[model samples]
Target chain A: MGTRDRIVAAADQVINELGLVRATTREIARAAGCSEALLYKHFSRKEDLFLAVLLERMPALTPAVTRLSGQVGFATVAENLEEFARAAIAFYRRSLPLSAGLLAERSLLEGFRAMLAETGGGPHLPIMMLGTYLRDEQKIGRVGADADPDAAAALLMGACFHRAVLAALVDLGPDDKAPGFVATLMAGLGPR
Target chain B: MGTRDRIVAAADQVINELGLVRATTREIARAAGCSEALLYKHFSRKEDLFLAVLLERMPALTPAVTRLSGQVGFATVAENLEEFARAAIAFYRRSLPLSAGLLAERSLLEGFRAMLAETGGGPHLPIMMLGTYLRDEQKIGRVGADADPDAAAALLMGACFHRAVLAALVDLGPDDKAPGFVATLMAGLGPR
Candidate 1:
């Protein structure tokens, strides 16, 4: 692969092992089989590399969310949401460990928050993106006009996120509960 | 209050400020204005003291949940669930910072898991309690007979949790979104 991709993959592995606060860029560069100078050529800050790992190597929630905008009127609302829920659950589950350290340290959390804010990112992205999708669907009579898109997005995504949080504490096994969650939500979102 | 209550209160404050791992029994005792030996008399272990703080000093979710069983046939299911959601959001928000330490370190998380297992407790209590309430409602035809009570319970509680998680990173302000969330879910929950 390319040097940039290698560096990002190495960052993910080291960060997963040592957490964000403890994982050093030098270790990441060594893991990538490159010099620190070479690593700096591609990404200047550790946060930049971390962001690359998040947006690239983490579960594909952003891409799936991006695709929602295109599927506005093409699919059943329930089906679209079910797909989103599955992706969200997987994403949250994969990313929870990375966040354990960030959330534990006050300064780390503040820096992470600033990094996210600077990039126009944070945990709120999915909610806003999906809310926009729901609003677009509403325009086409595919969704109930009175439905509160943002709140519905929050509820649906929040349920997936909660499942991930619980899974972090215990084994939730192979059972897939997202479909049932989306179906129940669909009962409320149907055009009225 | 009494000495026992004083220790529990001190533990709650200390743990909230310093997290679960770093907040020691000594510090907690000092905060309570008591000796270490006296602190041990009221609570045999720090875990016991932490549990007491969670149950007694945090937001009253346990009591609100216990009250649900008695309201099986009395109130609207939507109203009951909404009340539970508010209590849960408050409870989760309060307990999250305390958990930051437990979840961040591998050994600490393992110890916490063991402690929770020994006490027959973890994060599953609320889901089980609310699910039982829904089942009871179903027996009286207050809820749909075919509804998956556990999934519904998980979704409602998870949404509350997700809201708290977001509020942790960014201010969600004074606006209450729990009611709208419950309203949407209730549309599906109402007995046909």
Candidate 2:
């Protein structure tokens, strides 16, 4: 990888380990086997470096969410939900530290808001896509015709995010419990 | 309030405004109008002060939650949900600063975990209370008997918390959309 890429990767590692508060340019330079000047040559500030790291990492999550959405039609709603649940669990497990750090940093939110304005927030984008899918499902009578697709989409996505946060924050064992949680949620909201 | 209480409250305000990293004991003591030594007399460390502030704020949330739950049969589920939604919105609005600060501090999850442990973290308390009302409705054929009370409880509570967090983080408007969100979720999950 290029020096810029290495610096960004090192910043991500440092941020994950020591948190954004303590992830200094010097530490990142050390991690990348470079001088602090070289690090600053690529990024103007620590915040810029952090944003670059987030942008780099976010693309990895998009495909996973897209893949899960594609798998929705292959099985029953409950099964599809279980698949989504598992995917969410895996995604959060990998991204928790960074996600947690970002959530903890208000300045990061400014950067993220700018990124969202530019590229659409990676996490929120999936929910919008899922909203469209849910609208289609409602029209097809797979979901209740009376159901507000936008609201349903928000609920489904919100529930998944909430569950993932809970799992990451609390020590919920990774048995089939998550899948079961998703299944139960699906049952609660499934076609009556 | 006592000097110790003032110090803790000052710490809470500072942390809420400037975040945990930036909120120093000196700043807190200044805000409290007390000497740093006096501040230190009450809490040995920053973590302890933070925890104390959180504990002071935490008790307020539970009583509000319980009060909402008790309103179950006194009003229609929809009516109760609407009232709960409004209360929840107000609660979250007031708590948003604290929530944002906690997230920024990266200590919310830890505090939440501690709180949950002390309060008995299980599906039972919330489930049982809401389930009783749901069950009563189902027995009267208001809700479908096939509905899973546990699942329904999770859905209702989850939707409320999810909407609250979203409202706190994003501008969903002053209409208090939680009721609409909850209503739609209920419609999706309610008796056909």
Candidate 3:
């Protein structure tokens, strides 16, 4: 890996372990097996280094969300939601340590916000995609057209996100129960 | 307020202003007009201080949600759903800062879990309440008994929570079209 990539990887680990409050540049350098001077050579500041870590990780997340939306078939909605939920849980589980770190470091918000806007994914994309899907389903009479698809999409995505967030906090297991939960959610949102 | 409460209150302001990472014990002590030793005397560590702040704030979140649920009446199911949706939105809005702060801090999870279990609220309460309401409505033939209340609740809660989270991230309004959203979700989840 390049010096910059090595710096980011080490930073991710440090942030995960020590949290943003305690992860100093010197510690990150030691974790990367590089000198502090070398670390500064790649990134001007700690905030810049943290942003690199986020950018490196974000690309991996988008495909997991978008791929499910591309699946074809009504029978697949439950499955799609389940897969998406599992993927989300996995992503957060891995990232939670870093996320907690970033959150603790108040300085990172501006950089994080910039990254989210530039990347076009954070939490909103999934909701919008699901909303659009619900709208289309309504048009086909598969779901009720009279209802607002945006709201429905927002609701379904919200529940899944909330559960995933809670699960991340508690380390809930991923099993067949995930699909069951999604099924229950669908039933709640399905037409009469 | 006692020394402990003063410390916690200071921690809350620091957390809100600086984000969790930047809110150091030194800063908190300075904010509280006390020495670092005094701060430590009151709370074992920074995590303990954070927990104190959350414990102080989380309980007040439920009453608004309960009030919203109670507002639902015998009008069109859509009207009731709209009331629920609005209540959900307001609750989320008020809690967003706290949620964001907690999202940043991993140590707060235990406190959050305890709070949820004790108060019978938190992220899951909305979905569970909506599920029960829908189930009752279904049983009474107000909603089709064949309809799945669990799924409906998930759908409704998910949309509202998702929207609130998104709104916190982006500067979006409350999607004032909740009535339409309710209609669509109910149509899907309602009885044949």
Candidate 4:
């Protein structure tokens, strides 16, 4: 593997073990078998490295959500939503620890927010994308006419996100309910 | 206020400002105008003080949820749930920062789990209570027989939790959709 990939892999391991707040860049470099200077040469900051690890090593919902806009009229809405909800729950479980660290400290939260501002990236991205997809479905007369796209998006994503949050806070083994949740929601969201 | 109440209030302020993990007992005692000995006398542990703050200072969903089971056949299901959802959302927003610090460090999380075990207290209590309430409603035929109460409870509380989480992570002012979300879910959960 190349230097960048090696560094990201090392970061993924270190962060998962020590969490995002406690995982030092020095330790990550040592894990990667590289010096701190070399690590800095590849990534501008620790946050950049963390972001790379999240994107490269973790399951991301962005790809699936992006693909959803194209499936507006092809499949049943319930089936499509259940698939998306399942993928989103998995993504959230992986990403929560990485992001939870940002909330633990004030400066870290601000720095992370600033980084997101620079990159035009934040947690709101997925919700916005999902809302747009629902809107597209609405245009095709697949989603109900009076459904609030933004509210529906928030509810769907929020449910998935909460399931991950609960699992992280406590032991919720085999408590997966994404499919049933989607089914119940789709029943309410059926075309008018 | 008495010494115990004073300590609890002071701990609330300190924990809110410095977060739960960083707020030292010394700082809390100083804020309360009491010696560390006096603080320790009043509260055996910092976690106890944090719990007191959560139960005493912050809004709690327990009372609302507890009252819900008694109201099974009284009001419209949608209205009752919307009220509960709003309260849960508000409670989650207040309690999130306090609980989030525990997840940042491994030792803190372990300490918290141990504390919860001793007290038989954890995050699952609300979901269990809500699920029981839903079952009561199902018995009265106010809720559909096919509905999964546990899943419904998780989705309802989870959506509220995620709304708070999202707002904490980003700027989402006036994005409150608890009423509409309840309306949508209730449409699916109506009596068969």
Q: Write candidate 1's Cα lDDT for A99-154 as tens digits.
A: 66667666656767777767667888789999899888878877766677777788
DockQ of each: 0.37, 0.33, 0.40, 0.40
Q: Give the candidate order by descending TM-score.
A: 4, 1, 2, 3
Residues A78-158, candidate 3: write the lDDT tens digits.
676677666654554566555545544546655665656766556576667766665555555655434555665565555
- Backbone clash pairs for candidate 4 read none
Please provide TM-scores, in order, for all candidate models, with all chains considered together. 0.84, 0.79, 0.73, 0.87
**After best superposition, candidate 1 residue B58: deviation in angstroms?**
1.2
Which residue window of length 10 is worst by lDDT in model 4 chain A?
Answer: A183-192
By TM-score, the best candidate is 4
Residue B85 C-alpha lDDT in model 4: 92
lDDT of 3 by residue, B1-192 (tens): 888888988988887787764678999999989999999998875656765675574434356446545544466566777877777766665455556566655565556665556655455555677777776666556676567676666666666665666665554654575675577665552123
Top DockQ model: 4
lDDT of 1: 0.78
* lDDT at position B150, candidate 3: 67
Itemize residue pairs with steric clashes in candidate 1.
none
Please list the C-alpha lDDT of all candidates, in the order they appear. Answer: 0.78, 0.60, 0.64, 0.78
Q: Per-residue alpha-carbon lDDT of model 4 for A1-192, expressed as tens digits?
A: 999999999988887788777788899999999999999999987778877877778897878887788788878777777788989999988877777777766666777777887887877788788889887877877777766676677777887887776676566678558777876665542112
List, residue by residue over B36-126, the lDDT tens digit for candidate 4. 9999987787667777888888887888887787788888877788889999999988887776776766676776677887887778789
TM-score, predicted candidate 1 vs. hidden true structure: 0.84
